[model samples]
Target: MKKLCSVMAGCAVLAMLPLTAFAYPIDVQKQLNGLSIDYNSYDTDNDIASIQVNNYGSTDAICRVVFNNGPESPRTRTIEVPAGKHKNATAKFTRTIIKMRINLTCTPK
Candidate 1:
């Protein structure tokens, strides 16, 4: 019975492995070509903060965003913008901060 319980638990853990997104391989830089992606604007009003990207090209765009503030450690993300559409990547701080700088580059993979 103990052996059966351990086997069942192991199987259950393996069964749920597919729920993780990092389980597979991903290539980032090669995926950013043939599209228009830019940091259009940013707004940090109230408790909310977001970075917006616009894609004007016929194809979708993927970009890597690096956000930095003097006091806090820098953060980054891989953002996807649909063709002719835009997207916003967001972040939150424990308390209100002064300023945040946004930088973006093409995504590969």
Candidate 2:
């Protein structure tokens, strides 16, 4: 009876482990025109924050990117790159924002 009770307690503890020790990956890709913009969250203690943008298209593209902190204001930058290349850009923010806006323009190969 003692061994059976111990085994049941051990099984209960193992079942709770999955609830606390679980991780989920996020996918942040949206398509526009002929380009697929892939974005991911980044963390930094410095004053500037950088985002990785990948061009998943067949042709060269130019990205008109905008970073907003809230309803207050936003910063913009343009990045020109060929296909299968990744670009990095930094945006200085006074406060954290809810979402980011990424606009792209595809150029002929």
Candidate 3:
């Protein structure tokens, strides 16, 4: 019984390892001009955030991405995506992020 209890405790500790990671919620606001635009947002790290923009329209596109973290100045990035291509925009913040907001705007080129 003593050995069983020790093994159970070890298992519990291992199981809890994955729970130590902090994952925050991400919110996105987008505006696209009659084009098919898809985006994915990620809280890549404690101070880093990224967004992936996918353009599925027949025409190339110019995209503007804005990343906002609480109490931090917003970061802006511009990218050009060809038809059926994808692009990534990333920003790093000075402080750890509790929540992330992304604004995406795309226009045909």
lDDT of 3 by residue, 24-104 (tens): 899999999999999989888888999999998899999999899879899999999999999999999999999999989
How do all models score by TM-score? Answer: 0.56, 0.52, 0.88
Q: What lDDT score is found at residue 34 in candidate 2?
A: 56
**Per-residue lDDT of candidate 1, residues 50-85 (tens digit):** 667778777766777766654777678788777788
* Candidate 2 per-residue C-alpha lDDT over 34-81 given as tens digits, one digit per residue, 9 for 90 to 100: 566565545332233456777777677776656544465667777775
The predicted structure with the larger TM-score, 1 or 3, is 3
In terms of TM-score, the best-performing candidate is 3
Off by over 4 Å in 1: 1-35
Write down the lDDT of every candidate, Cα atoms only.
Answer: 0.61, 0.57, 0.92
Q: Of the candidates numbered 2 and 3, which has the greater TM-score value?
A: 3
Error of 2 at 26 (Å): 12
Off by over 4 Å in 3: 2-6, 9-13
Segments of candidate 2 deviating more than 4 angstroms: 1-31, 95-109
